[model samples]
Target: MFFVTVDEKVKDAGPDDLIMEIPKLGTKIVCPTYFLVLPYEDFDYQDEDEDYLPERKYSVAIVLNFWKHTVRKMKDNETRYLPLLFHEVGMGCFKVIKEKNELRMAFGFTDDFAGDGLNIDRDSLEDFSKSVQSIDVLTMSACSPRIFQVTRKSDNPDEPVVSFNISIDECIQDVNNSRNKLR
Candidate 1:
């Protein structure tokens, strides 16, 4: 029994390169799953009390249905999805925007997260969000440690896919961490 890596494709064309296939090679344990924190949008808006203040922004995370793309996961059933690969809920593909400095330590994927590697972007995350809001991902227990966005091929709910996003930060972090450990 040999091992292999399957680079699966997303639904149609929206979530591509973000992993959609994984044959499990041979003698593998549970199917490998993936999750990514793609480009997060910045919602720079003032509350009702609009005072001349600093630019305080909140995060908008759009979870892609990579782990068994399902429209139902976005609207209802925050938990428990039949089609979903991992029988869990919360933090699917949703647009995420948060302050750069206020990265909350609190994490949600720690629970029932039958996946590995919280892949992220390595480049200008802020700029990526401004120019492009989102991409697509399969999240189908095969999404490699990378970034992606969700998009619909057609206005109709039938067509959709995920695309890849070159994450510079992730790369840097990977390298830096490896270097530190080696030292």
Candidate 2:
């Protein structure tokens, strides 16, 4: 498991200038007042001597930060939602959207990754994408242990193929509550 530590320089900075540093990865992520951290695991593969080797690894947590003014603008536009960020990873990308009342997230994987052991349900994925809630609860649930789990839905439960147990509603709720508190 990896850990996050705050940089000392951030202490002297203003609210809009917080910096988060992950010592293990020697990486620093800048935030514009509001942010959330979500953990995910990715795999690396290598081919040698006509043999394929897959290595499952833990990568740095995904840090999502948003500007306060941007969110305010989103709220003012009742019929539209703002796309905050699109973060690409080893096998796929994560898209974060901010609506007038909630936050939405979508995860997409490459065709190659899908052909591997990952099995995603299209209907569930769509529902997850549409579900909206408070961001504070969402972030808190994501950070909490066991809130998100990998479950196998195939007839052979012993199979390594699995899907992520996503509770998008909870995540949104948490985020909303946190944002309100900050305000």
Candidate 3:
């Protein structure tokens, strides 16, 4: 009677019927994640933190609104702590603090200097742009279908306090569309 001995080389290998070298499949996002990036000018986080970042006094703050499903994945799968994981990306992210109720808050961008109460320059586009671009925390965030709401005081004679809202979605869409300009 001939008997075969157990081979030590393949001890760890089990189920000869199964295919060897089966690689783990990577997951693909069928529904692509998207964000809305809002630019905030003259953003401030903390007084002492000003010198911490060398970029400048002003920076672009990024605000992102994500799909609820995406948020769940980030929380459950990512294992990111709630306190550390930021659902939105921006200095004006009052929602985050409010949701957490931690009493921590950061100043956000406005049409003008918030405390000074001075209206933004008539043609302060450059200052505003630079400020938005300079945002320390959210400067590098990406977005799709970006939208912006700008507030401006009305020039009506009768109304002492009137503000108008403007939508900058077109500008954002243009940027997204022309991401790769051929010319």
Q: Specify the highest-lDDT model's number.
A: 2
Runs of candidate 3 exceeding 4 Å displacement: 1-112, 117-122, 131-134, 138-183
Residues 1-183, model 2: lDDT tens digits: 112222233322122233333233332333321111111122211222311111100011112112223333443223211122112211222334555455443322232222222212333233323332222212211322221222222354333221122233444443344334322
Model 2 clash tally, residue pairs: 18
Q: State model 1's lDDT.
A: 0.23
Name model 2 segments beyond 4 Å from true.
1-89, 110-149, 152-183
Clashes found in each candidate (C-alpha, N, C closer than 3 A): 41, 18, 6
Indicate whether candidate 2 or candidate 3 has the larger lDDT: 2
lDDT of each: 0.23, 0.26, 0.20
Q: lDDT by residue for model 1 over 56-172, one digit each (tens)?
A: 010101112121122212232122211112212322332322223111111012122323222233222222222332233333243332333222233433322222221324323
Residue 116 displacement in candidate 3 (angstroms): 3.0
- Candidate 1 ranges with C-alpha deviation above 4 Å: 1-47, 51-89, 92-156, 159-161, 165-183
C-alpha root-mean-square deviation, candidate 3: 25.5
TM-score of 1: 0.17
